[model samples]
Target: MNNPFNPSFGKVPNIFLDRAHAVTKLSTELQNPNSPYQTTLIYGVRGVGKTSLLTDVGNKMSAKKNWLVVNLTTNYNVLQTLIDSICQKSSPEIKRLLDKIEGIKLSAFGIQFEYRLQELTETNYQILLENILDKLQAKNISLLVTIDEVDPTPEIKNFISLYQLLIRENYQISLIMTGLPNKLSELQNDDVLTFLLRSARMELSNLDLLSIKHSYQDTFAKKGITISDDVLIAMVKKTKGYAYSFQLLGYLLWEIADKKITLATLEQIQGEYLATLGRNVYYKVLQELSPVDHSFVIAMAKAPTQVVTTAYLQQKLDKPKNYLSMYRKRLLDAQVIKSPARGMLEFTLPYFKEYILENLKFYV
Candidate 1:
């Protein structure tokens, strides 16, 4: 049977686990133009399923009556790209509105019809989008803008500003974006887009262990693979409740398994695929940290035990409690680390501590 595990980013998984409440709530909000979550920021470190949640929410909303999903990419001229996307995916009724937008004519033709159509400027992309939004609003239709991989880019800032204006005009639209914690921190500094700070925030975290266990078993059984309970538990433990690792482990294990998945089958996967999964998911998370946060993380990794307290970290790094507190909040916001108690900290990703120890020299 083909491997059911899909490790690629942004692609919705075949066996999605957890985040049901959040997804359902966001889906319901699509019908309410005034939902506070109408402009939401779904953020987390790499491989935490931010894109999956964002995409799933968009898909659910698109299925609703008279709702449209406009997905944006990190390309030149975000406004122009948005204009083109709305034009392309819009219903015929909406298309009539987009057909009147000016500058987008130059963008849509991409020099192919430059001779027939006069070159136009994109300064009024907001006007174009507002016209489209007003037409849809009249028809009682709404638009949901889903953007992935947010960064501190000029085009993105401009896009946010434009959205702000449309919101003031009461166009029926919602903007959902995903970004790393640090990138989002910087983006919020833009005075014009500072309103994003008030937007609802959904920080993606690891899946529930029970959710992973059931989803894993169900997916495997459907493929005619008899997975023992012990092996199933071991697989979930190795995945660390991360969505990406869940897919990676299952894909590798299925590649080598016969009709049954035994304890032996789980053992067969450890040497190479396990390390590959760690590097793919864990290292990228480390890169997302700021230099100070990275140093703080390395200190926690070198600590004597899995759980470290703020006092212990302060002593280990010879820093003040205030300094540790600041980085702690930063890491927590990034979802790279979690606080299990009043002051105790632990890495959120499974096998992450082990990975840190093995690469301490380079990271330090």
Candidate 2:
């Protein structure tokens, strides 16, 4: 039996995968002999297929061309680690290059090589990199380095500086990176990174409605499960084009089906079940908040509708009106709520909105 919960790393064929057009275009560009941007950055919101897309692209690039692809994800210190990982990937060549450089000691034992950058100045390091890049270029092997979750690392700034230097001096290596939505902003604030940002920005394609439907139908069909159009539409509506949510919903519904999902079972999913899911999700989000903010969240959750007014919440939470903005900023930083319109705030997690509404009394 095929696994419906494909949250794992490996790509599954015949599964409900989308983003073909975008992947194809990226493949073409990366493989292009004349392609300019040695480094590319792909950005999107979380669970929007960023990982899947990069995985697919990396697989394609590695299999077809002489591209040396390494995909690494980092939550912190990505730049130093990225350089270290890349140097590790190029270890054999690094050993060979260091061997050739006078007064440098290089030794390789088993799969590990120990060396000292102490004997080498920054200029020597740059020269060694250039020599390795030339050797790689000679072999027609472009180093495609991809780093995910790049924002948390301060080293990213340094890495970008080094990468821009390599590009300026014409290295054959290329980079593809993805991270939190605000990462680009962080990168752009620096002068060198601002220059690179303009040169190498590549946007990931979003899944369209048709792609969503096709993916749902295909995934279910593979499992011998079928869902009605109405149920499919509802799932799509709830997911709001989020790729992970779509996969999560599909996986959950497959379990709910227990055999074959039909129009009946689809419609049979009660609001209670949805509300329960929402509550669990919202509760987890609440766990991250302080006691006071949690109370403020409860007040907002107790409201009947999606739109929560500041005046009403202030009165309910017994906070002064002037403090609303402060509360709002705190929640915003915590990413609990987003202000869609002026004076109107909504939970970033829609399911949490439902969760809070039904479970507010318990928490309160």
Candidate 3:
């Protein structure tokens, strides 16, 4: 049988955990004219389901008759891509209206449009987008733009500035963006993008342990397989309630287990599980950190408890309290580590300490 669990990034899995609350809140707010959620930002660590949650919310809104959802990526001119996406998804009547605008020609190749200009200025792009929004508004259609993996680029800043203007003009337009915490922090600090600081921020957290357990039990039962309570709990604990880990462990378990799961089956996948996570998530996470940030993380990894005290870290790194405090706030803003209480810190990703310990030589 095909694997029911999907460990791939950005792809929604067959047996997904229900984040109905987040999905509902965003979908409902976007439909409301006065809701502040019209512009929402979702930020989280890698593989914590930021992209998946954004996709789910977009899909929910797109199902409505009056909603036109357009997904954009940061790899190109965002404004041009927005126009192309809007035109592609628009109805035939709306397409004709947009095509009638001078200098904007809709290509016969699936509604992609070309602007007759050597270079499109910010003002020019805004005017073109305003014209299109006018057409969409005439049909009483609300536009929802979803951009994944947002970064602080000139293209993004330009698009966001225009987006703010469109919002002020009271167009039936909304934007939802997803990015890593550090990337979002960078965007938030941009003077031109200060409007983003006011956006409704949703920081994705780890899944509930109970929820993860139930999802596993239900999924295994559907496959006519049974897992003892002990073995099931052990498997769930291994996932650490992180979304990607849940899927990865479930995918591995589904492939190796037969009609019944035993502790032995769980034992078989341990090496592969940790190794895969290191390659897919941890390595990339480390690459994003600076040399000092590496030292901070390494210091925390040496703590006996998952939650490390600030005093302990200060002593371990042999840095002054003030010096360590700067890195503490930096990591907090990056969401690499979170403070569970005053003068304490902990890694946001599950099994991160173990991953660090296993690869200590390279990091050192």
Candidate 4:
């Protein structure tokens, strides 16, 4: 059998685990005509599966007959990308409508047309988009715009501002954006994007160990493989409930093991596993953090124990307790660290503390 596991970041697994509820919630909202979640943001650290979740939900959403899912990336001009994606739709009806409005034949055959009227030659994006929406909504269709790894640039802000206007006019549209906490936080500071603050916030948390273990066991068994109980437990523990690691471990193990999982195989892939996490998650996360936030991570790393006291963090940074609060909050917001107890702190990402220690000189 071909490999069922997909380790590449953002590739949705054939069998997704630990996020059914969020998917169900999004599905319900997509089907509902009036959903406050129309403007949704899925925020998480790298490898926490924001993209996977977005893909899953977008898939479920686009399955409906009246819904159009436009999956986009932040690589290009956001507005132009949206326009290109919409125009690039292969649906016969969508192509027909675009051609009818633009007075240009756009289809697989070839582009051939001229303006039937002088008035049709000049059309703005807003008018063209609104006309497209009007045509779709007239047929009781809704648009679902899903953007992965969203960057909150001026272009994105402009897109949000325009989208907010569409919402005010009661357009049948929904937007789903996935991004790191730091980039998402930038949206919160933009006055134009204030409408987005009211949208549903689904922060990706660590997958539960129980969910991870059951999924691994069931998926392996389906492929005619039986993993020892201890190996299953060890696999889940090593994954630390991170979503990408869940797939990464399974992919690595499936390659080496014949019919059964072994500890030796687990030990064999340990270094590549860590290096993958560093390349995929750690570097991306640190690249987005400000200097102050890096200092906060370094200070926390210097603490003697994993559970560092808040007071100790302040003293180590040689800053007043109140002054240190900003960085502390920044780290907490980024999900790099969590307040385990009332006053205790610890890194949330598995092996993050080690990654920090190994790269302290650069960050400091």
The candidate maximizing TM-score is 3
Candidate 3 positional error at 230, Å: 2.1
lDDT (10s digit) by residue, model 4, range 67-178: 8889977764565456656667636776777777764456676544444554443245566677677777877888889988888877777777888888888889889999
Q: Which regions of candidate 2 are displaced past 4 Å?
A: 8-16, 33-37, 75-125, 200-206, 256-259, 262-303, 307-350, 355-364
Candidate 1 residue-wise lDDT at 317 = 86
> How do the predictions measure up, each by TM-score?
0.89, 0.70, 0.94, 0.90
- Model 2 RMSD vs true structure: 5.5
Off by over 4 Å in 3: 110-116, 304-307, 339-342
**Model 2: per-residue Cα lDDT at residue 246:** 60
Q: Report the CA-based lDDT of candidate 1 relative to the real structure.
A: 0.79
**Taking the tens digit of each residue's C-alpha lDDT, what string does model 1 give over 39-133?**
98888778878888888898888787788889997668787677667667776666665555543343344311122234345545566667667
lDDT by residue for model 3 over 1-364, one digit each (tens)? 6888999988767766757788888988888899889999998888888888888888988899899999998876777778878888887888899898765887678544355465466567777889889988998999999889898888888788888988999999999999988888888889888988899999887789889888889889888999989988998888877889999999999998889988898889988999999999999998899999999999899889999999899889999999998989888877678888998788877788999988889998
Clashing pairs in 2: none
Candidate 2 lDDT over 132-163, as tens digits, reads 56767766668787776566355567666777
Better of 1 and 2 by lDDT: 1
- The clash tally of candidate 1 reads 0
For each candidate, the alpha-carbon lDDT, in order, equals 0.79, 0.63, 0.86, 0.80
lDDT of residue 348 for candidate 3? 76
